[model samples]
Target: MPPNINNTTQLAQNSDKMAAPISPEETLARFEELSVLEAEFEDAELELIRKSTALNEPLWKKRAEIVAKIPHFWTLVLEQIPVELETFIQPTDFQLFANSLQTIEVSRFEIDDPKGSPRSFSIKFGFDDNEYFFNKELEKKFWYRKSKDWAGLVSEPVKIVWKKGKDLTEGLTDAAYDLAQAKKTLAKTSGGKSKAKAEASLPEYKTLASKIEDDTEGAPSFFTWFGFVSSYRWISAEESEEADKEEKTRLEKLKRGEKLDDDEDEDDEDDDADYQETEVFPQGDECATLLAEDVWPSALRYFKQAHEADDEELSEIDVDDMDQDDSDGEIDIRGLVSKGRTSSTSPPSKKQRKA
Candidate 1:
């Protein structure tokens, strides 16, 4: 009876030990569950964005009407843009914007599209008859997309159609546009072969590559963003949907405790490595995001900041002028009177009082 009791106690201890440790597969399954919850949270965030966009539309239109009456409204707002965006704006670019950039508008172009994301937005720059471009309005659309290798907002290069001798981007936009178009042509001609294999065959690619290499300018103009493509390569809607399906299948397998092929990750890495390098406006997405999220919604705040900056500059100039006056032996009677009042023990002389 004592031996039997000890065996049962040992079995109970073994059971406790086994139950205390979780298998790697089980841990991975739990992580996948958390991922699903995170995806749900993202969906909720998108819904909130859609709701807020609807609410803000009327206010934006009203603000636009009021802003139209204010001279250099867009210019002031842009001037007070965050330093992150300021880096891209060259002196020439600012001058152009100040002269011609009348109105800036942002719209969630895909807000109502069931197939499209609310995150997808279009930035429209309304210009007065400018020497730089013929177009009264230049609009750039960014699509929120996902691919097997990368995911974010992707945009095709916009043709600026620059006026003669007034090209701010120094032919960078033209070159970028040409290069993108050439790639598309080549891709179709070469039966979707690797771009690298056919890149040398395209004169447009060489021209852009030469331009990029010859560029001594530390940072390209903000206008170059008009020709902005993806930070990675451009992924079309169809490709994005296919990638989404593939990812869903992968995740489903992960949830089912299936071992994923190591080669799958390697293939993804290879795809990333194949991304075309664009030195021209590599931070385009970031700049676009800043314009859409920060600059657009808070234009009034930025306009106020611009005014505040002007006030600060004026105050600084006043102080400097006062210092200069003092250096030149000029006396301020008001300051003298104030000092006299503060130090009641010392009475002003008749000569000082008169002054």
Candidate 2:
């Protein structure tokens, strides 16, 4: 038969066989080492995020600048020349406008009730050099409502073909090529150098993504509800799987007595616990009383002894009168001898006889 599982009392009696507990100083030193490692890991993670954001900023800014120049190109075609001379105007006129455009203003309006549709609402925004196009001061009149109604109409609308830009298209192509080359160069550099390069090229304007495609028509605004361009740091499933495989291989190698780096050993050691800690109720609640007549007699006895000890301390006079006096606080020598003699039914010993 298997050896009996000892109760808390037996374990306490035999506790001398167990190893001595670790010193408080050693425990504190280990905790401090872990804290330093945690801080370093956090700093490294933060730096990665900062680098990715820096690289993505310039790409978005250049795109915004390109979108901003679009207004002037159309302005030259429809407004600068007479209507009769519209057909004679070459595509080069737009190219010049696009190339020369340094800056432009864009306005937005929310119309609660636009003409031809009072029940419905609409949002209108785009680049228009002349304020007269949006009813001169319609933005001001509907400022409280944040709506610019059709009452602000001041000029005839002009048609713009979004398809062709001649030399401006070539310029965009060159800019894209240059940006791509710069990105490739940055990618080649290790760590912080790449971030520095990207930060240097960042534009002054806040860059927002328009996700504009050449196919998009009748969209005069540089802004769109589509989305924005940003950088992300994430691990793919394949990469995660690879990392797990690497860890398993390193552990196997270590188990086979192969020399491995200190980091690998530390990682493996961290995965294990120095002790198995658990909470157990030796004597369960009232519900357990129906399961067994004496569900945990030993635990009940232990607790009873503890409670009696407390009672004895509180009622020291009542206990001491029946006990013997001693220099020790808890040694009830006379009480113990009397109880033993009463239970044994044997003849008194020399010590008892003398007492």
Candidate 3:
């Protein structure tokens, strides 16, 4: 203004100053604040789950007793599972569910544990002397855990102990169990060294890999879920706790504007690069979550849905038959009478006659 500068020029200069790039430090600080907020939200969610689980315990038990008396109740409920889970259930699996599946229950097994997560749960399946497996009750548990590079539900393969020639999974479960045992043995013998260094030497591992590759079936059996492991590498509870603590410490330092060492960052990258190679049931976690969250809590609704579907099918068939009869210029008077419909040939009602 002192030098007769144009007002438009001054305004444009001010806009340019306002549009200056954010410093990396400021950007990182903002990101850290958001990360902390996300963590708080997660903690809140877990607290709510814990509270709800307690409130629903007695109700779940009562519901289980009621459904147990209804023949094929679990089977019908399973049939109404989401398509993502339905795709994994082969024809053989359905047969097992229909014939022998007696009861299905989902429980938050670790809800009370201080270190454990309310999100951790188990799927328990009861069978009535099934021809498939030796276990009368099969329960698969999933632990909500965190590792350095990954986190979520992790489970050890539940051994099915199949009857001779009755394994619905076609030996996949057996092979998976063997491989897991072999790895455990190897880990103990090798004094905590990485199992991958000598995994190729293990016969159990090779056999399972070959079996998985040679499978010609369109989809693996739902029973194979008993052999499911973590989506990433399996981490023990102790290891998970250690990793969680370390992560919390790292985040604290990040929030305080402390720079992470270059070497530590490089090491973390290397750890992430070591991906787990074997995956018996990749969608097992999703299936387990669906069973726990949707199928378990809403069993009655799903059962009703199944019945509604059957009724709709029958109604459609009746409509189609009626159309065919009309097209043929014939009417089934008995059919109309059975459905409580008056035939055209019937005499007029008293009200109609009066009109």
Candidate 4:
């Protein structure tokens, strides 16, 4: 009787030993599941990246288009700017704006209208050797009806005047208008009296723009008549006071033996290069979110997950681990499964080191 009992005990032990830990196929299946999750994440990240790139393109295009118009604006404002422009113009400035405009190839012109004289928002033209300008809401008249589908037609043609054109005067407004919203931004950065002065001169600047234009083009629109107008304003009395030291030093240099060549003598390099107004499509919050903030992390996460899954890192736990006696005597199916993945019999890098 004792021998039979021992034999029965031994048989039970053998049976327990024979029970499988986990099948190789099940482990592979878990890895495949991880791969799938990673794949989905990867696809989402890639799509998001594409969307981000698309988002920035429009802004770049807008900026490029608007920058193209800078020369026309600078020409209009050259003589009128209260402070003389800095004479130095390196190639970098041209590359930044005017050069870029020639690439977009948009048709542009200005004309005169009754809404106002060649000021504020009207247009003008030149006949023999004279230039013209104007101040008018320039609207691109699109002939969408030519496309042959009534539903296909866009409701409004592409039209642009100045930025928020309402809060401006006739003579000074064109400077602000031609620059789009840059003068406001510049004034804000400059602050106090300078800002006030810029605000004051907006009407006169606008009037100035309405007068001059690039005469090569045909009859211009009230909007196009103003080739372009710079929003740069005078150095205030305070600014002149502040520059006294620098001017004194320059004068001393001249007295000592420096020859001062006047600007009028130099063939001015219409240095319209570095001037950037609000017209340029600028990347700030929206662009940063799409390009750097949103897509790459998601992509990297998915890529790393796929790599770990491919290496069979989740194969350490088996069914017996799930079946192990619990402290509370409760069956914990969740203990057997890990994040809904349960088939691995091998180990991850962290677990392998311990093994």
Counted clashes in each candidate structure:
0, 2, 0, 45
Model 1 bad stretches (over 4 Å): 1-23, 193-196, 251-274, 311-355
- Candidate number with the higher TM-score (1 or 2): 1
lDDT per residue (tens digit) for residues 120-155 in model 1: 999999999877889888999999888765678889
* Candidate number with greatest TM-score: 3
Q: Against the true structure, what is every candidate's RMSD?
A: 13.4, 40.1, 11.9, 34.8
Question: What lDDT does each candidate get?
Answer: 0.72, 0.29, 0.71, 0.30
Ranking by TM-score: 3, 1, 4, 2
Q: Which candidate model has the greater lDDT, 2 or 4? A: 4
TM-score of 1: 0.76
Q: In candidate 4, which residue ranges exceed 4 Å CA deviation?
A: 1-182, 189-228, 231-245, 256-273, 276-355
Q: Which stretches of candidate 2 lie above 4 Å from their native place? A: 1-19, 22-232, 236-242, 257-259, 263-355
lDDT string for model 2 (1-355, tens) is 1121110112222225575555554454444444445445644754554454356447535644664554332232222233223332233332222333233222112222122211111122233233112221111001111011111111111122122342222222223233334544654663433343352353311111011233233312211110111111112223334543654464465345454453332232222321101001111111122111121112234334433443344324233333233432233422321232333343323232233
Better of 1 and 3 by TM-score: 3
Show pairs that collide, candidate 2: 110-147, 135-152
In candidate 1, which residue pairs get closer than 3 Å at backbone N, Cα or C atoms, i.e. clash?
Answer: none
Question: Positional deviation of 18 in candidate 4, in angstroms?
Answer: 99
CA-RMSD of model 1: 13.4
Listed in order, each prediction's TM-score against the native is: 0.76, 0.16, 0.78, 0.17
Cα miss at 84, model 1 (Å)? 0.9
State the lDDT of candidate 3 residue by residue for 37-123, as single tens digits. Answer: 666778899999988898998998999888878777887787777887677776557666666788888889888898787889999
